[model samples]
Target chain A: MRWDFASVFDNTDALLVGAAGTLRIFAICLVLGLSLGLLVGLGRYSRNRWLHIPATIFVEFFRNTPVLVQILWFYFALPILLPFQISPLAAASLGISLNSAAFSAEIYRGGIQSIETGQWDGARALGMRWGQAMRRIILPQALKRMLPALTNRAIEIFKMSTLASAVAYVELLQQGKLIASLNYNPIEAYTAVAVIFFVFLWPLVQFSYFLERRLRRDE
Target chain B: MAYQWDFSPVLANAPLLVEGLVNTLRITGTALVFGVALGLGLALLRLSPRRYLSWPAGFVIEVFRTTPPLVQLFWFFFAMPILVGIEMTPFMAGAVTFSIQSASFFAEVFRAGIQSIERGQWDGARALGMRHDQAMRRIILPQAVKRMIPAFMERAIELMKTTTLIATISYADLLFAANEVSQKTFRPLETYTVVALIYFVVIFLASQVARLVELRLARSGESTVH
Candidate 1:
């Protein structure tokens, strides 16, 4: 019943590397997912069915399925389908971003919808092109409303980066699992990782709350 | 560039996949019932006036909610027996962790739903000389329950997807069975594609149902809810 963190401390370098791997994937997915999501979000708002239907399907397929399953599918199926090999790290990143892109698209769509139709029409009335209107008027307003939700989603994908461990990407949880099994002390290892994650993520969670309150006050 | 795209290997192993799917539902359903009840209790504790009662519950709920459920799954599956001196089967560990994780989320949903009720309703109940418990039970909950339905179902869909994490610990879940079959048959593409399709269909249907419920509630003028 005695807890020993000595074994965990001994492996701090490995865990740090693992945490670095997680952050790397998190950073990659955050950029790719949100960018792709923005495109898809625009597609969702487009008048053309060509854009709308496909965007909706993409969002629905990724959002409905579990990210773990999606990761496995990417790790296994994509290489075969492409007739080329994908490194596991790339596969995991692709999977996570695609999954996150689905949610991001919806979040973006919601933000856009939250804007009044009158503001949209007013932009047109002001002799602005669609792109100019969006960039100048609609976006400035929607981004403020959407910042908190988007940050929350970003934090979510950051936590989800741990699932890369399932694909053998050697992220934080995998590092901890290996160490725990090696040292015959699963409790200590998991406890260490839990504390690490809490310390790392608690700030983001706090910031998300602050954003939520600030947004509420603005309303 | 010619891939055969054979699916016979996966089709031959349909029974195992079905069993795994059923197991997935079982885990999610069991977790949902207990999680929601425990969540309601946690919400009550959090709403209690006494800090001694609410603070600990609030802290636990926040920690669980913020942390990844996958890590929690690992801790419960690997660390719990060592810490508590109680041996838990893989399924039991999965169920317990998911229950706790889902409870944390549901607590927030319930709290939000309760808080979304207008203050005038509380004032009206007070003016009528109704006790707090009576007002909550008789006046507030009926309305809140209706609002909670769409959100609860959405969480249920999310919870169903999350149950797949149990496969990592070698539980015989749909994804696990698919993995086993693919490994044996050397048809990873076929087996995994089918598994993905199954998940897509199930969750897609659930989301559609949730959307219909939300639309109906909105049509009926119950849209001013959390």
Candidate 2:
């Protein structure tokens, strides 16, 4: 029933490093997942069968399975499929990016689809090439619309990054487990971890809300 | 060089995987029922006019939703015994934690459903001289529940997938069974692939059902509106 803050305070540096590691995992996943997802997303909307089919399979396959299973698969099995071994961080990031890419692709597709048909027509009416229109006309507006969803996915990625610990990645949750088991103070250790998550995530949630409000106002 | 993909290890351990799948479903089903019940209660509390009732409820809901479920799971399984002076089995701890955390998310969905009912619905209820509780139960809820069906189904799908977290606590759930089979057979690749496929099939089917329900809800909502 009693919580000892002293044990938690004593391991502050370790927890902070764990948190930084977590942030790094999240950052890499967000950047790579979205970049790859952008391509896959455009492929999702593509008319060609070759591009569209693979993209659909990729999205559905990743979306349907648990990210945890994927992480385990990457950690335990992926190296067997490849020539070389990967570090835990590398394996974890690979698995998470694949999962994130699926959801991110959907978010991108949603953003692109939301733009009015007339916007495309308007671009053509101005005699702009398709590439010119996509880059300068459609993309700018689509990026604005996608920000809130991307913000949401960022939060999702943050939460999912906690799974890295299960794969021996030495992330925040794993570190908390170590410190707690060592200190025999689960309450204090877990409370610190929970507080850290809340502090980091609350702002992203607020930002998503604010963006939603602003976007709704724009309409 | 060619790599061999063996299915014999997974096939040999089929019974355990099947048992694990069933356990996973059982856990998810229990959590869904408890989560919805708790969520509805919390939603009503947050919607209450009394500051004393609503304020604390909102705070609890906010904190639950903001934190990762894994942390909560660990806290409940590991810390609960020390704090509460009663030991719980892994299943019991998981059920309680997932229910509460799922309730937090479901509470928000319920709030949105209730709020989305047009203000005119309330006015109409009042014009008919219905009391607040009566109006909510008899009129507002029936429609709101219909609108909420799609969201609830989607969350159900998500919750089902989250059942895998129980494996972390050494629960002999599907993923844990997969791990054991892999270690036993020394075919980690084959075993995890099978587990992933099982998840893919189950979730894919659930999502399709959700889509169908969504379409039906959309049609009914349109008619109900007019």
Per-residue accuracy of model 1 over B145-220 as CA lDDT, tens digit each: 7878887888889899999999999989899998999998899999999999999999899999999999998899
As a whole number from 0 to 100, the lDDT of residue B21 in candidate 1 is 97
Give lDDT tens digits, candidate 2, residues A26-145: 999989888998999998988899999999999999989988999999989888888998788888888789988999999888888888989999999999998898888888999999
Best by DockQ: 1
For all candidates, what are the clash counts? 0, 0
Give the per-residue lDDT digits (tens) of candidate 1, residues A35-128. Answer: 9999999899888999999999999899999999999998987678886787778888998899889998988888888999999899999999
Position A72, candidate 2: lDDT: 93
At residue B222, give the lDDT of candidate 2.
37
Candidate 2 — which residues are off by over 4 angstroms? B221-226
For candidate 2, give the lDDT of residue A18.
96
Q: What is the DockQ of each candidate?
A: 0.83, 0.82
